[model samples]
Structure formats: C-alpha cells, structure tokens
Target chain A: MIRILIFCLSLLCCHHLVARKPEPEHIQIQPVFGTENLKLNTYYLLNNHTDSILIETLRFYISGIEFFSRGECVYKEKNSFHLVDLAKPQSLNISLAGLAGLEYDQLTFNLGIDSTTNVSGAMGGELDPSTGMYWTWQSGYINFKLEGHYHSGATKMQQFVYHLGGYAYPFAGIQQVKLPCKPNQNHILILALDYLLQADFSAIHPNIMSPGAEAVQMAKMVAAQFSLKE
Target chain B: MIHVPLKLAVICFGLAACRSNSSSFEKPAEWPEPVYDFSKNPLSTEKTTLGRALFYDPILSADNTISCASCHSPYNAFTHGDHNVSHGIGDSTGTRNSPPLMNLAWHTSFMWNGAINHLDMQALAPINHPDEMGENTAHVLQKLNASNFYRQLFYNAFGDSTATGENLLKAIAQFMVSLVSANSKYDQVKRNQASFTAQEQNGYALFTQHCNKCHTEPLFSNFRFENNGLPIDSSFNDYGRMQITQDPQDSLKFKVPTLRNIEFSFPYMHDGRFKTISEVLNHYTSGIKESSTLSPLLLNPMVLSSNEKVDLLAFLLTLSDREFLFNPAFAYPKELFLPAPKD
Candidate 1:
C-alpha cells in the first residue's frame, strides 16, 4: 500500500512537469484589397494598429482577418472587426492568447468599414465616433479616415478629414492594406498623410459623409499610394 | 467566481433584467396581420415596455429636451398634431413635416422622401442630424447606462444588461411596430360589420379608380416613389428621392404617403406645401409638372367638382380610429414617472 501511494505521488508530479508554458506568438498580417496585398510606405509593416510595442501611432481598420501558415488557412473570421483609432487605440501588449510563437507566414485584414456594420447599431471599442470614422448622416460610417499637415501653396496646413467609404454603388468602400512582418520580429507601420499628396490630387474627394460610389473610387485612388520594401 | 454560491448572483442578475410584470399588447380581431417581421425579434411585454420608456424619456436628445414622443405623440396616431414642419431639439425645425407613425409595419420605407432603408436605422437620422436631436448614439447609451431604469429595461429586452446599439434600435422598432392602427370605420366597412353611406361609397369608388392605383386599399398607400407634381419651393427646393439616388430620371419623385386618416395627417406632400385637401386635389387636377419623373397616372387630370371633394373628405374622415389614438397602454406610464409629462 505504501509503494502504491508513493507511485501515485510520482505520477502526479510527472504530469505537471510536462505541462507546457505559454510562449510569445509569431503573427503575420497581410492586408488584401480585392485581389492584391496592400502595402504602406514601401514596407508591409503593421497598417492599422490600435496598440503596438513597435510604434507610437498606428491607426487603421481591419476589414477582414485571414490567418494561415504553410499554405493551409487556419483561422478566418469574415467579420472579425478591428479598428486602430488614435482616440481609442489599444495598448499593444503581445500575448499568447491569440497569436504567439506560432508559425504564421500568411494573414489578411480589411482596411475599411463594411456594409453590415455601417448599418448596425452603436459599437464599442474602435468604432467610437472619437475615432472619427462615423459620418453624421445620411447613412453608413467612414471606412478610412486620415488627417495630417501638408504644404498647400507653400504654407503647411492641418486638420483634414480623409474619410473614405461607399458600399452601395455607385459608391464602393474597399480599401486593401498589407502589413509585412520582418522575419522573426514584429513590424511597425507608418503611413504618413504624404501618401495622398504623392498621388494625383484630382482623383481624391475630400470630406465624404456617406458610403456611396464616390467614396469607393477615392479609396482605390488612395490604395494606389501604398508600396512594399522588398 | 464560478465556484462561489451562485444563488446571490442569480438574484442580482434577475433583478437587473427588470422583466415586465405586465401582460403583452394585444391586437383587435378585425385588424389585418401586421407588416413587421417578428421572427427576428419575438414580441414580449418586457421589450415593448422598455421601448415605451425610451420613447417617453428626454435623455435621447442632445440636451435632454426631446424624445420620440415629443414629435410623435400617442394621441395623434403617433404624429405631431398640426405641425407642417417638425420641431426638434432647441426649437430647430426640420424642412419636412412630421408624419404619423402608426401602422409602420406596412411601410416599405420611412420619412417624407424614403431616406431611411430600414426601420432600425430610422432614429439615427434624427439623433445624428445637427438640426434634429443632435445626440450621438454613444452618448445616449452612456446616459442610459447611468440610469438604473434604462439599464434594467435594456437587460429585460436583451438577455444581457449591456446596452448596445442593436438593442436600442430594436427596442425602438418594437415600440413602433406595436403602434398598430386598424380599427377605423373604413376597416369595419371592409369587414362587412358596417356599410358606408352612398357618398362615402362613391368616394371610395373614385379612390379605387383614380387614387387606389397609388393609395391601395386596406393599407391606403402603395409605398412607391412618385412625382405628383408640385411647383418647387424657391426656399427649400427639396427633390425627395432624387437626392439619394442622384438619377435625373428620379428627379421629383417622393414616397407616396399612406392616405389612412388623411384628414388628420395633412397638410399633405413632403414639404407640407398643401395645408388643405382641396389644395392637394387642385394640384392633382391641373398642376402636375411635366417632368420625366412624374407618375403616369397623374399625367391626365381628374376634375373632382366641389361636391366630389366633400365626398372624398367624407371618406377620409372615416379612416380615423379614436380608440387607437386614445389607447391608455400607449399613454404616459404614470406608475414609472415621478411627475407626469406636461402638455
């Protein structure tokens, strides 16, 4: 009886020793607009991030989330929403709860608001109007909002609303953004407002208030401003 | 948290939900089936009660001044009586008049121009518009969350105590849906419980031929966008559905409003341009704008003489349901409020 009791105690101890400790995750974010990977500032770093250890400000909305590694797509939530607004940006603290120390070479997310959410009721977190994604009227939320200072006739000006959205045609709001990971290290994405200035100004329409055909066309014009490092 | 005795937590959570102690609202037997889709959100007394409370509460406005009931009073078939243009927060008036809101289940679209696509999104227009309530949903939710009454009501309407935009819109829609009106004299005439006078019968026949194509029987509106030609107002120059669609072909078309209780619902048209039914009839008779968008039915004029106009007015008067207008269930809940609302 004594030997049996001693054996049971040893077995319990061995089981605990084998319990695995949670480790940091490897995550790769890819922004896809239509059929292409969306890159920003010649580097596919994190595009729209709420909180990040790598950067002070990374603002954007993740329209769609796609997780995959080794050609096998693992996690895909069509409506997994993520908005990285400066007003309510989440403090980026890496955790193993979702993506940690896992081989993920492929991931995708949306860069603008979708139709259903645009019509749905009050949303918490990134969707707050403080983020400036909300339109006062007639319908739908602004998918992509960017503000920055630039030289207009030689004087630097600020306070611009780069609201882009249009789900119902002739307004389509599909913004594709890509965040490339630096092998083995999380990346930082900085999309300065200079991207709009770089593009042909004639294509961009400022101060959009609803999702319609014009908003979608402007989003595409802005998407043309993005590029990759490698 | 799970391991502790759960009874105390259960009791607290149950109290927080504030489920109604009253029975659910019932419909009259003679009424037709409701147009609201109930499968999405089942009807329960708790939800309607929550909706009614929200409807009456002034916290919905930016400055705590207006509620849904402010413009859509229960006594006027859920409409503002005698207001051509609706008055909103801070005495700011809207361009279009406030229309009656009962029998909403039958409406294909909302507003004078059918701007809102769904019933759930209707309140957003008023709440967010600068000239209207000027309140944002987020702030409204915060105010509601602070109140024990609203939190409990939200909890009861939804399974969770968390007040969300979905629950708020749903609650509002539930109340609007509950504002069903179908017990008028015209309804009884159709059901064979009563018969109309000869003049009224003649007016209804004229309505069937000349107006029924647009204002269909039973519901008294096809809910279509039509250009019943009116000269543009130089001040407002509002071109109803054309603004939303942007198609020149849809230029002057506005949603054909229901003619139910037409006598009380007027002044007619989107802009309240016609203060009397005679003016409206005159426009139909000789004032149709020859735009590409005008309804085909109104291209030719109908010459309704003065006597015929009176007959038509007689028909419209029979559409009012005093019982629905005076329903105590829809009245202010005296039991809940500390002080009754002032007239």
Candidate 2:
C-alpha cells in the first residue's frame, strides 16, 4: 500500500513539471509591394500601375510586442525587439517561446523602438548600433528605412530614401500598431509597401534622412501599412 | 525563523559585493546626481582599464592614424591646444572645435550643437565623421575582432572575447564618465579646505554678476544652447544648434562650455575664435553681435574694466585642478598597450 501511494505522488509531480513547460509560437513578417512579394532591385509598378519603383533596400525595427485577450494583456514578449531586413530571409520569421497556453486574440507592437530604449545607451542584438539602422550623426534608432529609385516619365530616375526616427518632442516617430489575431495560431504580419509608395513623391520629397515633420508624417504612413494576414 | 537570519546575512553580503564592484565611479557629496545612468553599465576596474586602452587606440580611426586622445589630450584638459578646430584622419580639418572631456557624467548632451544625446552614442559621431576618425562602427568592430590584444581586453571587460558594438561603446563610455573634475581650488574653497585671494574674491564677485547666469558655478555651465551674440562665420556656414534642430530660432547657438580648466583649455568658443581668456572677456564686453536669438542674459551690454578683467582671470585660474590634470590613472595606459599581448 505504501509503495503504491509513493508511485502515485511521483506521477503527480511529473505531471506538474510537464504542465509548467511553455510551447513556442512563431510570428512571420512578410514584406509585400502591392499583391506581390517584395524583391530588392526589382521594379514594381505603382500608382495604378503607371509609375515604376525599384527597391534597393528595406529595413526597419519591430519592438515591444504584446498580446491581449478580452481587452486585457495576456502575454508580453520579454526583450521584444526584431530587425527585419529585406536582404535577410531568416530575419523575416521571429520565434517567440514560453507562450504556451496563452489565450490571446489581439496583438500589439511598436513600429519602432520605444523612447525609453532610445535614451538608454548602447544595446545589443537587433537594437545594436552596428545594425546601420541607428543614426550616427544623431543618437536615435532609424525606425524605418526604404531606399529605392522612382521613375515617372521622361525625367531621370530619382532616388527616394526615407530614414525615419526621432524620440524627442514635436517629432517623435515611433508608431504603435494593433491587429486582431486568432488565439493559439501562428501569426503572419504583412507590411504593404504600396501605401507608402502611393504618396506624391514630389510634394513629400524623395529624400528624408533626419527626424522632423516629414519623418513623423512618413512614419505614420508606413505604420498604417501593417496588417494581419488572414 | 533561524533560516531568516541567515538569508538576511546573505542579502547584506551580496549588497556589499555589488557596492565594491561599482566603487570605481563615485559621486561627490556636494554635486547633483550624474546625468549618465550607472545602473545600465555598472563601473568595474577591468572595464575602465579596457576603456582607457581603447581611448588611446588609433584602430578606432580609418588608416589607424588618429585616436580620441589625438583630438582630446589630457594635458589640455582634453581639448586640442593651439588648434582652432579639430584635425582628424588624413589631416582633415573639422569645422567645430573639439570640446574638452571632463565632468562628462554631468552633461546631458554633447557637441557644440548638442548633436549626441548620450555618452555611449557620442563616440559614434567622431568615429564616423568623414572629417574626424572616418571609420564606420562595423569596420571598427571587424578590426577589433581581428586584433588579439583587443580580444583579450574585451574578454576581461565583458567576459567575452568578441568585440560587439554595444560592449565597445559601453567600455569607451566607462572611461569617459570616470573623468570627474571636482577637485579644483574653487571646489576646495567651497569645501572650506582653502580660501581665495582678495583679487580672486573680487573676480568671483564679478563672475557672479556677469557670467554666472550662463556659466553657473560648481560645474561652471548651465549646459544650455545659447546664441552668445557672435556673428556667424560665413566660411564654415555653421549654424550651430540650428543645424541640428532645423529651428531658425536656434541660429548661432552653442552649448555653454564648462569653465573648469579654462586656464589650460585655450582658444575658447565653439569655433575656438578667441585665443585667450582676455579675448573671450573682450568679446563679452564689446564684441557681442546682436541677433534674434541672442541669450537674454547677454541682451544687455556687458562692460568690464581692464582691471576687472584681470581680477576675473585670476578667479578663472582658480578653477584649474592640477590633481585632475596630472592624475596618473587618467593618463595613457602604456603598460597595457606597449609590448602587444601574444595571441
């Protein structure tokens, strides 16, 4: 009888240990130009398929990922910062662990690094200054970078480069994005580059390197392009 | 209940160990809390020693010709003496004067125009500037990784041999933030350990009346970007703070520099326009070119008699901290750099 009781208690302890382990969840980010996948150096038709744009570089930061269920936060990813680059295929897929059994229907994240992290000196991993996403002339992370050439007509192809970032007042460029998601399912987040290309390039100017009113406006346009892939 | 006392003792021991590890950086009792956050990058002897080596290493610059100390020498209180502007890699001359690097823990921003927001990020400006070090952080990391000496230093400082940008910048910041200059005779006078001469006392009074608003006492700088009414030098076309902020109102504005070690840090001003303190005093009295954004404190004309200028100069001399200038700990680490470590 004593041996049987000890066996049952060991079984219960093993079950508890198994229950404490968390399962991994993946978040895949897909960058697209219109309905097609984004390809660097490939010209894509824009503005009712009239103007053509050739993307040379596309890099941005995604940070502060959090999940919500029933209007309450269910899970927040620790050290949630990822640098997604068009050139690096592996960076597009982000694996989040220790989120097993989490009931989350909504996802929220910052399109750029937060102000607190910006002021904090020197960070490793995706937020590292060596990533080239950081502004060297000034001390702020470049939230979104898109460099390419645009051709409209008989005019020469113009280069359009947008490096958007600023943490200070009157021009803070970080944008928060929230999307509805199905619980317990791997998520696919789509970033549509067409919406950003649709803007009148002449009025906005093809070159924006520093953070200012133009950067803030451009960041807002870019932030609006993120959506959950159904 | 008996175990609780043992736990308390363990906690106390842990706290003591932590304190000893970070004791490399100390805050003076009279000064305000430092602007640089210490908790993020705690001070340690190994890290600071590594930082000192990096500060003197030319590998940070392109062509390995110039280091930070080239432009910011300790003898001149970190400013390049006799040079109006900074001379960089390939003999390139920069537009603005290289500012001194002391009491940096108190400064909230860096550069003449306050371009850098943090000390860790400040080195990036010069390292990448075409007219300065002319090297990118990525290449610098590759070079550092290739060097066995740097690898060992990195291992000692960060407990890893690989040279990452984060650790590199943090190590450099440790050396910079450790440069605290609070041991001047002026400070001693405030501490009641010394007294100022009658001439210095008169000069101190004059300084309080004329310059104290901008160059405040103790740290000797309010650290605000103010247009001090100097006419723009069209050659450089440098708009000072306006270049950074894109605000027309900030035109001709520059960060107010600390008055400590004013005696040795010659050729003053953002452009190093004045060669002597008397010349600087002359600018305040007669050469303030009025502008839309001129500092309000300088809005009124300042008139100092020649004798009063002499007295003020005497008071400024009291700010020169010989101990800080000659501190062997702050000097070049020859033992670490010479006779390169074997791989």
Strongest candidate by TM-score:
2
- Candidate 1 chain B: worst 10 consecutive residues by lDDT? B1-10
Which DockQ-derived CAPRI band holds candidate 1? acceptable
Per-model DockQ against the true two-chain complex: 0.23, 0.73
lDDT of 1 by residue, B1-343 (tens): 0112243244236644555444444655644565555665677776776777778877888998888888888766676767777789999988887777877876767777776756666777777776778888878878877766676667766766777776777777777778877878998887788999999988777777788988876778788888887777778878888777676877778888777767667667777778888888778777777777778887888878888877887888888887777888888755455442458
lDDT of 2 at B298: 90
lDDT score, candidate 2: 0.86
Q: Which ten residues in a row have the lowest lDDT in candidate 2 chain A?
A: A195-204
Which residue pairs clash within candidate 2?
A: none
lDDT by residue (tens digit), candidate 2, A1-230:
99999999999999999877765777888999888988999988877666788899999989988889988998888989999998999999888776667887888999898888998899998888998989888889999999999887746687888899998887899999999987654688999988778777533688999989989988988888899886
Error of model 2, residue B279, in angstroms: 0.7
Which candidate leads the pack in DockQ?
2
